[model samples]
Target chain A: MAAWGQRLAGVRGVLLDISGVLFDGAEGSGVPIAGSVEAVARLKRSRLKVRFCTNESQKSLGDLVELLQQLGFDISEGEVTAPAPATCLILKERGLRPYLLISDGIRSEFDQIDTSNPNCVVIADAGESFSYQNMNKAFQVLMELENPVLISLGKGRYYKETSGLMLDVGAYVKALEYACGIEAEVVGKPSPEYFKSALQEMGLEAHQAIMIGDDIVGDVGGAQRCGMRALQVRTGKFRKISPEFTASPPLFC
Target chain B: MAAWGQRLAGVRGVLLDISGVLFDGAEGSGVPIAGSVEAVARLKRSRLKVRFCTNESQKSLGDLVELLQQLGFDISEGEVTAPAPATCLILKERGLRPYLLISDGIRSEFDQIDTSNPNCVVIADAGESFSYQNMNKAFQVLMELENPVLISLGKGRYYKETSGLMLDVGAYVKALEYACGIEAEVVGKPSPEYFKSALQEMGLEAHQAIMIGDDIVGDVGGAQRCGMRALQVRTGKFRKISPEFTASPPLFC
Candidate 1:
């Protein structure tokens, strides 16, 4: 057997990052990576349970799944564990109303939550809506509350797009954190709870699952911290080998 | 003599913060603080030289001086040391053209500098202009450079206005810094060079001057760090007593 195949012998389940692993794009369009569609199908054909874990907050899960399907990927909304749905669940569980600073495309995801007289600030990839007015409004809402709550969807610094690299939600989250002198509660990617939830959905232990992703920090490092074996791919935002990744280089790439 | 009087016995010059000390307002109008205008005249009557050192980047020095003069302050444009004018001088000295991310009110301050093809990013209190497009543009410019340079007008987290406390340039600067993985060069308050320049203009050393302002960090702490005796005021953004101010409470509050 190959080195990768030998390593995956004991893995019962797999968590895959969608953006850089399956496909990479901005807006509603995505160009599937070469052989990625077949790769995902092949993984599903095997006995291993599969889950798509993504930190994408710009689109609704349904919209994202539809986009993936359009590109001939065998994916479903139920199998995708994204940040928006996780954030919505967290809001519902805590009974917290959020003043959302997110993109227009994902607004429907939070339609069920009460937003009037918001007690907390929920920030995501706002895209062009990350204006001074919106940010200031979110800041004011947090400052007015006795105990300020800022919930960030994801904490990626920047993401690649067709145009170029663009600022992400984490950068704006840091801005609010600095201005209000408070740390934000992140709900996606490297959050231990997020990773654990995905594992629980698969009905598998952390050690039983393996993660394949392009993001070093959010995916590989996050899954590794959760006791899962992780593999990095050099397709998307992988610039160079970081200190943390030096020990375990990308096996598949 | 009293404790404060004894402390000020050797002080040859006074560096006064304009916004919170003399008046406080938002937009174009300002309401002068009670007895502040008369206090300025009285200070000038004494032997101590006085200079208005401000981090007000939303407006030009001419406009700021005009507003102060309208409020019965015995002041001129030359006696005021503001961030915008100082930043322009720095850009010229370094021979770096900047893509300005500042408010429209202060745009004229950088008229002399070449901005055709920017080599650095200059950020300030952009007010409503801190949009996603503008910030992303600045980020792209910085990322494209071999060595990114971000020059900030002031590093204030938040400032007070008639409406409420609003986010300042420092918060946005932090956003850019985190996104680009680079530290910004602050050209305003708390910067040793800015303070020294104010002192040099007034023909006084750091030890021979006293700083009186409302902001604990920007005005009091910054001046203190530059070896000057600093006093805090209980106006504007001053909240509870911080650890750094425990030993030196606001003498004039």
Candidate 2:
């Protein structure tokens, strides 16, 4: 199956993670790694279903797609999938939109979340605009509603910088649960069901995609678990794995 | 119980991830989160069990304690437990690790899997480093042995980046099986027996020191199905939901 790269002569489908594989982790701006753009273009020419699977809770796929295109990459918003968007799915299925911890970076994604309705989905996040006041507001709605819940605990750090990674606002939402008492609903990777959901968008077997990323354990490890061929590209921050660190350890601990 | 965090003034046993949260992803440096020192101090001042847990694949509780101290967690590694480390408990008791996958990440985690000993303790996911060649190595050994399989699809990003959220790597490992056209062993989460192996740790009940990760559907959700009050943290990457994307939501599709 993996022979597709050699047999078909280009990646037929790609489950690319943003920030590391493609971008350098700027909030939304980054240079594609050497050979990454050409690699993507080659895949595109083959009509591969190139989907961007990101843990970034900050931006919508549409917005991210535009940014990627502007950055001289062939991309589309429909090709993007993220955790923040999972809230919309749970709400529709359960008939409950409860409350949401969102980011100003991707607040527009909530347009499908029905935030304007007086009794519709609630809004909450750890963005600079977030506050105890906003959390309290969400708390009130949660306490008052028959079934109040959270869209997600935005613990993902989608876009990164060179210095280090930051909390993926979802972490703040998780903290809110400790801040309060009720547990929030979640819908992202690490959650295999969420991966199944993402797979639905790709129209490919979960086993067919190759997850290429910079994070060794996060990107490569997770994909390996879900039954996909994963490549740990040294293109991102994880490459700094102390070259002294055993790449091919003998009798590993 | 969570209200305790409210009534109490200090953080208790800071729940930590094995690799990145405590140790660096590649086993390089133990770059702990900032405030860890103060959190430990505060927890100590508050008089709490300095307990910790991890998803480590290469060490026993004793080895992890040493590593934790070496990494500046200031806690005994004996106080820590990796999900895979407990495999010894089961294999020693049930007398089978299954020769299926033949491996998992971190060889130290599975002390019982002796490839030369005609055992069932299959070693599974070693990472992208785990591939067809490795599977063939596992298979060559397996064809000669006989026992239930031990499949190790390392779920979620085993290696991570400073940017993207955690992803699963099992997809590739499973792909190996697809390519090899054979079934392997099973020895990880959702393996009901593994839970007992963990419970045996610290002689605690399943109610004590439980793992609270994402996957209300997989880990938490399934646990609830198995009679457990799972706290589903919505922090992982796939938390968002859009109503339009529901399986039946024509708008989403």
For each of the candidates, what fraction of the native contacts does it recover? 0.79, 0.00
Candidate 1 C-alpha error for residue A20, in Å: 2.8
Candidate 2 TM-score, true structure as reference: 0.42
Q: Residue-wise lDDT of candidate 2 within A176-225, one digit each (tens)?
A: 44323346555664456655666788887766777666544445666678
User: Distance (Å) between predicted and true CA of A174, model 2?
Assistant: 3.2
Candidate 1 interface RMSD to the true structure = 0.6
TM-score of chain B of each: 0.94, 0.60
- Per-candidate total of colliding backbone pairs: 0, 88
After best superposition, candidate 2 residue B171: deviation in angstroms?
A: 34
DockQ measured for candidate 1: 0.82
Candidate 2 lDDT, B1-253, residue by residue in tens: 5763443333222233344333343333345445545555565576444445444443345665665576566686555544554555556676664443432335545554554454553444343333333444444443334332444533332233233222233333333333223454334444445444444553544444334443333344334443433443333322235111212111000
TM-score of chain A, cand. 1: 0.93
Clashing pairs in 1: none
